[model samples]
Target: MSASTTLWTDRPLLGFDTETTGTNVAADRIVTVALVHSVGPGRENETVATWLIDPEMDIPEPAQRVHGISTEHARAHGMKAAEALDEVAEMIADALRQDIPLVAFNISFDLAILENELTRLGLPTLTQRLGHDIAPVLDGLVLDRGVDRYRKGKRTLTDVLAHYGLEQDGRLHTADVDVSATLDVLRALTAKFPTLGTSSLEDLHREQMGWHRRWAEGMNEWLTKKGKTPDVNTVWPL
Candidate 1:
C-alpha cells in the first residue's frame, strides 16, 4: 500500500494469467483465465482461491501449440467469454481497490487486453474500477528480463522457468496450471533478488516500471543484433 510497506508479508497477492487466441492484446479474446490468491499470515498460510474461465473463441493451432488448449476442448468445457471476462475484471478491480498486489508474468499485456475486453463488453476498465492505473503489481517476466538480461536465450515462460530451475507440474496454456507455474516463477525471482522482495510495495511497483522499460530496450537491442526487429508493442502478457 505505502512506499515503505513490504508486500510479501504485509498483504495478500493475486497472481493472474489468461490464455488468448493470439498476441493482439486489444483484439484477441481470452481463451482461459486463472487467479491464484494468497491470503492470511505466513503461520496461517491460506491460499485464497483460483478461477478458471473457458474462453469461447476457437483456440487456433498456433495458440494451441503454445498453451495446449484446443478449441473443441474449450467449447465443451469453458464458460461464456463475456460472463467470465466480467467476473475476472471485477475480481481484479477488487484486488486493486483493496491494496492487494496483482502478480502476472507480463502485466501490461494482461491489463491492457483485459481493459479492451471490458470496454467491448460495456464493463468497467481496470482504471475505471480502481480509480487509477493498477499499482502494487508484480511481474515475474519483467523481473526476469530485468535481472537476467544476459541469460542468452528465449525469455519465454518455459525458458525462464528452466532458467530458474523451476518446473510446472502440468503443461502451459491451461489457466490454473500456468497461473501456478507463474506463481512459482514469481517466488523464484523475488527470492533470487532479495532487494525486490524486501522493498515496499509502492517502491517495488515503481522499480518494476523502470525494469520493464529496460528489459524492452535490451530485448530490442538483442533482436536488432540478430537482424530481427522486435515487436515494439510486445510489452507483457499477451
Candidate 2:
C-alpha cells in the first residue's frame, strides 16, 4: 500500500477469524481461532497467535468437511474450550482497549459466536470486558458490500480475496491462513477504494453498519422472492 494513504490499516491491524463446530451463533462452538497482527503489508512485521480448542461436542460432518477439524483431532490435542476462549477474549479486549480495529471477514458471525461462547463458559463477553460495545471493527465483508453494492457472486473470504487479486492458496477455511488472507484483502480493498482508505476508523465503522443493514434488507428481499426464508441479521457486530 502507498504510504500516502491515511488508512486505519496503516496502523497496527489485528485480523481475527474462527473455525467453528457449526453456523449457529447461539448453539455452535469455536474449534479454532486465529489473531494476526500486521504492522505493514507484504506480511512484514507480523505476529500470528492461534489456538485449537476442544469444543466439548461432536463436530458435525458438514463442519468437519468445511474446516477439516474432526472431533477426534481436537479431543486429542486441543485446549479446553473455556480455557482457550478466556485467553482469546482477553486478547481481543486488550487490543480494542488500545483502539485497534478487530478485522474479520464477516465479523458478526464470529464475534457473535464468541460472545455466546464467552457467556456459555461463565466468562465476561468482549463488551463486558471493555465496558462498551466493541468499536472500530473492520469487517471485510461489510467493506466489500459498502464498496461494491451490486457485485453478483459470493463474498466469502476466498471470493473477495480473488476479486481483489489476492490468491486463494486453497487455505481459505483454516483459521490463521484465513486471517492472513483477510488482512491482505483489506489492504487491497483500501488501495482500490480511496474513500474507504481515507476515512477515519470510526467513520468507516459506522458506514459499515449502514451498509450491512442495506445489504441484509436487499438479501432478504431476494430470499423472499425465491420462496426461501430470509435469515440475515442486520446487526453490525455482536
Candidate 3:
C-alpha cells in the first residue's frame, strides 16, 4: 500500500519479540525469537517465524520460570546463537527496508539486547544493516502509555491486553505467543484511538519516540525524588 493513501493499520506490520535469558539488555542472551508479518487491516495474511537459540550461557532459574525453557532443553534443541541472531537481524532489516513497522511490547529491551548480541558476535548490527538506526517501529507499550496517559496500574503486555479487553490463548513469555499478543494489542489500541490508525507509519514512529522520551524523563524524575539513581535511557530503540 502506498504511504500517502494508506493508514497505518492498512499497511503491513511486522511483529517481533524475544524470550531472553534475563532482563539485562546489555549482557543477556536470547533463548528464543519470533517475527510475525501481518498484512491488511483484518490480518488476512500472516507469516510467522520463530527460532529457539542456544544462548551459550546458563539460563537462570528465575528466567527459566518466566519462559519455561530450561538450559538443557535449549542446548539440546536450539540453533546456534550466531546463526539465529543473523537470521533475526536480517528479517528485521528486511521489514524496515519495506517500510513495515516492527510491532513489539517494550521494544527497547528487545532491540537493545539484539544489538548487543550482534555486536558480541561480530555481526553487523541493525543500524549497519539498515544504514541507519531502525525506525518506523510501533511499540505497543509506548503507544498505550501515549494515548492513555492517565490510566493507572501496570502497563505490561498482559496488563495492556487486559486493558484493551483482549486475551491470549497461549501463555505469555513465549516468543511467538508474545508477538501475536503484541500485534493484537496494537490493533485494539488503534480501534480505541482511531486517530492513531489514520496516521502514517513514519509519523506514528516519530510520535512514539517523543512519547517514550517524555515517559523516561518523568520516570527519572520520580526516581530522583525517591533518592534512587535514575537509570532509564531517554533514547529510542536503544
Please give the lDDT score at residue 102 for candidate 1.
88
Global local distance difference test of model 2: 0.89
Candidate number with the higher TM-score (1 or 3): 3
What is the Cα root-mean-square deviation between model 2 and the actual structure?
Answer: 2.1
Best by TM-score: 3
TM-score of 1: 0.82
Clashing pairs in 2: none
Candidates in order, TM-scores: namely: 0.82, 0.94, 0.96
For lDDT, the strongest prediction is 3
Model 1 local distance difference test score? 0.74
Write candidate 1's Cα lDDT for 65-163 as tens digits.
Answer: 977778888787777767888788888889888878888777787788888888887888778888876887888777787777677778778888898
RMSD of each: 3.6, 2.1, 1.6
User: Per-residue CA lDDT of candidate 3, range 124-236, in tens?
Assistant: 99999999879889999999999999899999888888888887878999888898888898888888898999887878888999999999999999999999999899998
How does model 2 score by TM-score? 0.94
